[model samples]
Target: MTLREFMVQRQPALCERWLDLLLADYGEETAANWRRERDPFANPIGHTFTTEAPRLVEAVSGDGKFDTVAAAALEAIIKIRSVQELAPSRAIAFVYMLRDVIRGELGTELARGAHATALATVDRRIERLALLAFDVYVRCREQVFRLRQDELKRSVASLLRRWHGSELPEPASEEVVHLSPPPNHAVRR
Candidate 1:
């Protein structure tokens, strides 16, 4: 079989294994439920894997110019994982699972030397995907941090407003509200 055909044939198993490994840290129950639950709302993690992994595999195997699509897929995965209780390393490490799959599936063909370059190319692409995942992961984290900071600011402002009994806040309670009677009304002829 041609290299591309082999890769295509193995995509399902690759994605399944990848998802299992990715969720393994959450424990066997999470991994098992993720595999079992096909519902999008109940098992978004599994949904993302089933939905994006095939496209990613295609992008990785495409001739030239797959980076954009691959990055999109990686970013989507990162966004979902980032919201979960995941460390940054664990969040992006799923990208490496593809490398493991490729190595295992293609090892014999790669050993024949005829397809060494092809195997190397795929490996290189997987590395690039990891970098993309990291970049996306960082951006996702920054967004989360910013959202938290905004929430904190809003909560503080609300508390201060409640304490001061007005929407406008003062540095000190002694500050006077000087309402100079409307100048135009006072000057009306």
Candidate 2:
């Protein structure tokens, strides 16, 4: 069979192995959701893994072109991983699992195989995906950092507004009672 035909036949198995490796990183309880539920709303992670992973494998296994959908799927998965307690390396390690899965799927065929070139092509595709994943991971972290910085800035601005408001004396009887500042008074921090 041609390499493309082989990859097509093995796509589902590849996704399954990749998902199994990925779930191994999480707690048993959390990982079980991925193995159990297939609903997108009920189990988004599982749905993404099962659905996107195969699409990604199919896309890359074709011509190794960069597909926006595949990249978005990778980004979504990475975004989820970025929030977890995993180290950055651990969070992105799932990308490398593709290599092992591919290797395992074509073991005999790859050994003294006339399709060595085709096998190398698949490996390169996985490497490209890994690089894309690293980029996604960096972006995810920067987005998280930006959000935190924005929140902090807002909180500081609010506190300053409150402190300044407190300094401006309240109007009496809820009316526009204007009063001049106390003579010779200066506010200091």
Candidate 3:
């Protein structure tokens, strides 16, 4: 069988292995808890892993074109990691871990020359996924940093007001633009 065929046949097992490796990074107890809790509301990170990992596996092994749904899934996972304050390397390591999962699953089939082209295709697709994930990770980290910066600004402003017993005046502008729409505008159906 072709590598893609094999990958499709093995996708569920591959995704589970990928998720297991991912949860392993969280330590044994948390991993077990995540594994056991199937409810998305109760265990969102675990839910994301269970739901999205399969999409990722299918994306890698199917048409090889990473689609928007897969990108969004990657974002969901990355956003969680970014908020958790993991180092960028740790946050994005799951993407790289998929490579090992696929390699391990393929085993001797990869060593045999039968599906070398298909294997290369899968590797290339995986590389593209990793690059996309890095982009998502960088964006998420930037957002987290911006949030922290904004919080710091708010805290300092609050402290200043409490210490000085006055609210800071809003910035004065010479010309203000009103954003309200005209009252005489016609209503459209």
Candidate 4:
């Protein structure tokens, strides 16, 4: 199923997890404040991570599915961090803002006396947002990987230069080298 459909289907569980995390971070009082600000918008979306994102992540540790969701959330968080230099709490707040927008626009009934149409419209919108969020997450991850790879290359090059060894090959110019398989030993008699 699509990510949006999966999230919607598992909304209740996810929300519970998210709530647990929020409470842990901000304590009951801060969680209550978050609920006041966020719960209203969460109703229509069928799921939310407002207070529960971190809690859900903790619950999913070592479980593959939860790890996947956490990875996506992390990537998105990283992108926001790189661009805005936000503190972790502030970055999470921005995630809530985006979630609110999705919930508000995609969870609303559109037009009068057309419930089916409204549902379809909302589904489409949610799917779109899911795609956008996923893309943002991927792009952020790719950028991070590129940065690390570049740093590693630079380090290796510097070490080689310091040793006064033969010039190291350019990372980009090096092709992926695969070893050939050994010849088969058994033959029909």
Candidate 5:
């Protein structure tokens, strides 16, 4: 059988194994909860894994483009991981794990050497997916940091207003706030 046909035939089992591996990274209790709960609202991570893994598998076994379906699936999973306690490496590691799932499912089929080139291509595609995941993770993290920075600025502004007991003049566009040299302290430089 052709590699694509083989992958398509095994897609369901492949996806389930992939999801199991993905959930295992979450730790025992959380993984158990995710496995037991199918409600998307109550268990979004699990939902994402179930819904997206198939799309990802389909993408891999098909024409291999970062098409809308594949991109959406990758983004959904990455968005969740970016907000969690996972480090960047851990967050994106799931993409690489898919390779193992596929290989495991293929078993002796992969060893036959007939599908070697096709399997190599699939491995490359998985690598590309992981890179896309890293981009998504970084973008999400930058957004999170910007939001925290904005909130911090607002808090500081409120504190400063309270300290002065009056409205402080707003800084002009692109203005930098500078402090006077501590009221007579020598300017060393």
Candidate 6:
């Protein structure tokens, strides 16, 4: 599916899943506080780049003949992001759009020879930033999952202790189960 389609289809579900995971990791009171403090909706990814990128291109290009073309390319990148929430896939498209803008501004012969050299620094930076964002999401989700599992285990242990009229097992020693990652061999290369 196209990146835009994927974002539309998956964003809400992903957000909900992450929120649920957060609730599991932190107790209800703490999670509520986190939601208020973090305010995820205020900093959505898709809307971040649209107008700013084109403005940057225009500023750099000045009144040169290629300025309009470069601006157009940047605008295209922003448009792609405008359809849905910001995502890694949209970031990838933005990188490509910027590359095209640079090439178009430089002319065909010069663009062919210098395009990669011109964009290498920016491309690397974008990739690094995208990866860092994704890493944060993964780490947060894992923490949430662990919190939920611990809470459930504690509740179970408490009930068992009461039933048996004995001391509860230590939380750390409890047999808390979790979903396992798929085996490496089962994954498509």
Off by over 4 Å in 4: 1-114, 156-189
32 in model 3: Cα distance from truth in Å? 0.5
Q: Pick the candidate with the highest lDDT.
A: 5
Best by TM-score: 5
Model 3, 107: alpha-carbon shift in Å? Answer: 0.9
The stretch of ten residues in a row with the least summed lDDT in candidate 1 is 180-189
Runs of candidate 3 exceeding 4 Å displacement: 152-189
Instruction: Report the C-alpha displacement of residue 12, candidate 4, in angstroms.
Output: 22
Q: What is the alpha-carbon lDDT of model 1 when measured against the actual structure?
A: 0.70
- Tens digit per residue, CA lDDT, model 5, 42-137: 988888888989999888788755476676788788888888898899988999999999889998788867699899889888877777777678
Q: What is the lDDT of candidate 2?
A: 0.73
Spell out the clash pairs found in candidate 5: none
How would the candidate models be sorted by TM-score, starting from the highest?
5, 2, 3, 1, 4, 6
- Evaluation by lDDT, superior candidate among 1 and 3: 3
Candidate 1 residues 148-187, lDDT tens each?
7665656688676777677544333123222222223221
Measured against the true structure, the TM-scores of the candidates, in listed sequence, are 0.75, 0.78, 0.77, 0.31, 0.78, 0.29
Candidate numbers, best lDDT first, in rank order: 5, 3, 2, 1, 4, 6
Candidate 2 residue-wise lDDT, 1-189, digit = tens? 977788899788778888888998887988887789977998887877777788778866887555666677787788888998789999999888887887787677667776888877877777777877777787677667766766565657757668787464332323422121222321111
RMSD of 5: 12.1
Name the lDDT of candidate 6. Answer: 0.40
- The 10-residue segment of model 3 with minimum total lDDT is 180-189
| Residues 80-178, model 6: lDDT tens digits | 333334454543343334334444433443434543443454444434333433333343345456667677877687577777666655553244332
Model 6 earns a TM-score of 0.29
